[model samples]
Target: MLEAVGLSARESAVYQALLTRPGADAARIAGDCGLAEAEVGAVLLRLVQDGLVVQSGRPTRYEATAPDVALGKLIGRQEQRLSAARLEMQRLTQMFRDAGAPGDAGQVEVVSGASAVSARVNRVYEAAHRQVRAFDRPPYMQRLGENLPLQQRRQREGVAFRTIYSRDALALPGRFQQDIELSCASGEQARVRPSLPTKLIMADESMAVVPMAMGEAFAETAYVIRSSALLAALSALFEHEWSRGVPLVAGPRRSSEQLDQPDEKTRALLGLLAGGLTDEAIARALGWSARTTQRRIAALHKELGVSTRFQAGAAARDRGWL
Candidate 1:
C-alpha cells in the first residue's frame, strides 16, 4: 500500500518506526524495524530529503512527518504521473491505429475455427469498456448460457449491453426464458427482430467480431474488425436495426383487469407479437401451450378492440402497453 505512493519497502518500514517512536535516533529505529544502523541512517536521510521525515537535535533524532500531509502529496504526485501515462497511451494507441494500411490485414483479421472464434469473441467482450452491441442469431459456437455470467459481470461493472435477438435465436428450446429473459433481468437491454442479416458483436466502437457465414458454417470463420470505416458502418447498421426492433421486457407475470393497463405478461406478449414471433415460438417463450397462446392473443385483440394482429399491435402501442 505504501509502495503505491512511491515509497520503498525499507523506507516505509523506517517511516512507520519513526511514526511510532518520534524523535528516535537511527539506532533506535534500526532496532525497532529490524534494520542495521547504517541502513536506517541512509533511509532516514532519503526520507528527510523527500520531506517524509524531519531531523532535529544535535544527536540527529528523526521524526516521521504527518502521514496525512506527506502521503497525500505522494499520492497526488503518483496520480498526476498516472494521468500523464494514460494520455500518452491513448496517443500511441491512436497512432498505431492510423498506421494500419488501407485494406490491410490489420484492419480486419480473419480467425478460423470454432475455438479460435470463441476465443476472439471472449476477448472482444472483455475489452469492452463503455458499451457492447450485438446481433444475436442462430448457429452459436458456444452453448446458450456460456456468455451469461460474463455479460452480467460486465453490466455490473457499468458496461452497457444491447442485444438484438433474431426470432430464430429465441425459438431455440428454452432460450427465451433461460437465456434472454435472464439476461434482461441482469441489466441487458434486449430487443428482438424477425431476422438478422448476420451475427455481430461490437465493443465500444473500437472493435467488432462478425461471423463470415450463417447457419451450419457460422463461427467456422470470423472477421475481427478493428477501428476502421467498416466498423463505423457496421455500428450504424446496428443502430438502424435496433431502431426497428421491438424491446424485450422481463418482469413478474401479474393479472390485470383492464386492457389499457396491461400487466407484465401482457407487455411481454405484445413485445413478442410485435417482434414477429410465430404462435408456437411465443408459446415456447411464455411457457404456454399453443391453444392457450392463441386464446390469449384473441383476448388481447378483443380487449384492444382490434380484429387483426397488426391492428392489435398498433392499438397496444397507442395504449403504451408495448
Candidate 2:
C-alpha cells in the first residue's frame, strides 16, 4: 500500500509500524523493523518531517500521528501541492502545445520498478484527454490489452488514436487480426510497423513511456517515463512510423456512406496495402488489373500527401477518413 500510493517501502513499513505501536521509541522501532537503532532514529526523523511521526520528551521519543489525521494531513498537503503544480503545468503546457514543439523537453520523470511502472502507465492513459498510442509487440498486447478498454471514452469526445503493431503480430493470424479489426471498427488507428520496443503513450506531446530494459523475453523490471524531451522523441517516432502504417476500415462513424455504397472494397484494399502488401497482391485480391489498382493507390497517396500507400492509409484511418 505504501509503494502503491507512491511511498517508499521503508517509509511505508515504518509508518505502519508506528501506527500499530502508537508510541514506540526509536530502539523499539528498530527492533520491530529489523533496523539499526540509528537507522530507526533517522527514519523517525523523516517521518516527523512528513508529519506522520511526532517527537516528544527531552530524549525524543517518537509517536505515530493518528492514522486518519496523519493520512488526511498528508493527502491535503499533497493535494495543495499538486493543484499548484498542475496550474503551473497548465500554463507551461499551453505554451508547449502552441509552440509547435521546440525540439525535446528539458525535464524527465523516471518511475522505476516493474509493477509500479506498469500501474503508472495505466494511470497515464486513464488521465489522458486526447488519444492513446500503443507500441504493442507480442504478448504485451495480449496481456495489456486485457486491461484496456477497446475504445476509450475520451475517443467518443474526439480523442484521435493511432496504434502501431509489428509485422510479426500477424503471426497470431486471424484471432489477433480480429481484435485489430475490432479496434479499427470502433475508433482506433491500427497499423503494422517493423521491430519495435515496448512503448506506451497518451496522445501527442502529453506523455511518452518506454521500458527501462528491452530483453528478448521480458525484462525483470521496467520504468515509466514522463518527460517533455522523451515525449517529443516518441511523438516524432510515432508519426514517422504512423506515416508508414497501413489503413483499415474504421468504425461505422468514420466510414458511413449509406447502405449500398459501403466503400468496403476500397477500404479493404487500403487495409492490405497499409499492412505493406504490394499493389499486385492488392489487385489480385480486389480482382482488378494491377495497373488500375496502382494508379488509384498512387492517387490516394498523393491526396494524403504521403509517399507510400501505407502511410496514406494510416494517416487516413487516424483522421477517421478511411
- What RMSD does model 2 have? 13.9
- Cα error, residue 119 of model 2, in Å, equals 1.6
Predicted candidate 2 versus true structure: per-residue lDDT over 43-162, tens digit per residue = 778889888889888776778888788787777777888899999997885665443322344545566555666665656555455667877655452352444363555467576777
lDDT by residue (tens digit), candidate 1, 1-322: 6999999999999999888899999999999999999999999999999899999999898899999999998999999999999999989855654433234434889999989999888876677878899999987778878999988887887899999999988777778777887887678888888899999998887888998877698779999998888998999999999999888766544456554477767777887888888999999888899999999999998899999889987888787676
Error of 1 at 189 (Å): 8.2
Q: Note the Cα lDDT for every prediction shown.
A: 0.85, 0.64
TM-scores for all candidates? 0.64, 0.46
**Over 4 Å off, model 1:** 92-109, 113-134, 141-164, 171-191, 201-208, 215-217, 224-265, 278-311
Worst 10 residues of 1 by lDDT: 97-106
Candidate 2 runs further than 4 Å off: 1-114, 141-145, 148-150, 173-178, 216-220, 250-270, 277-322
Q: How far out, in Å, is residue 252 in model 2?
A: 4.3
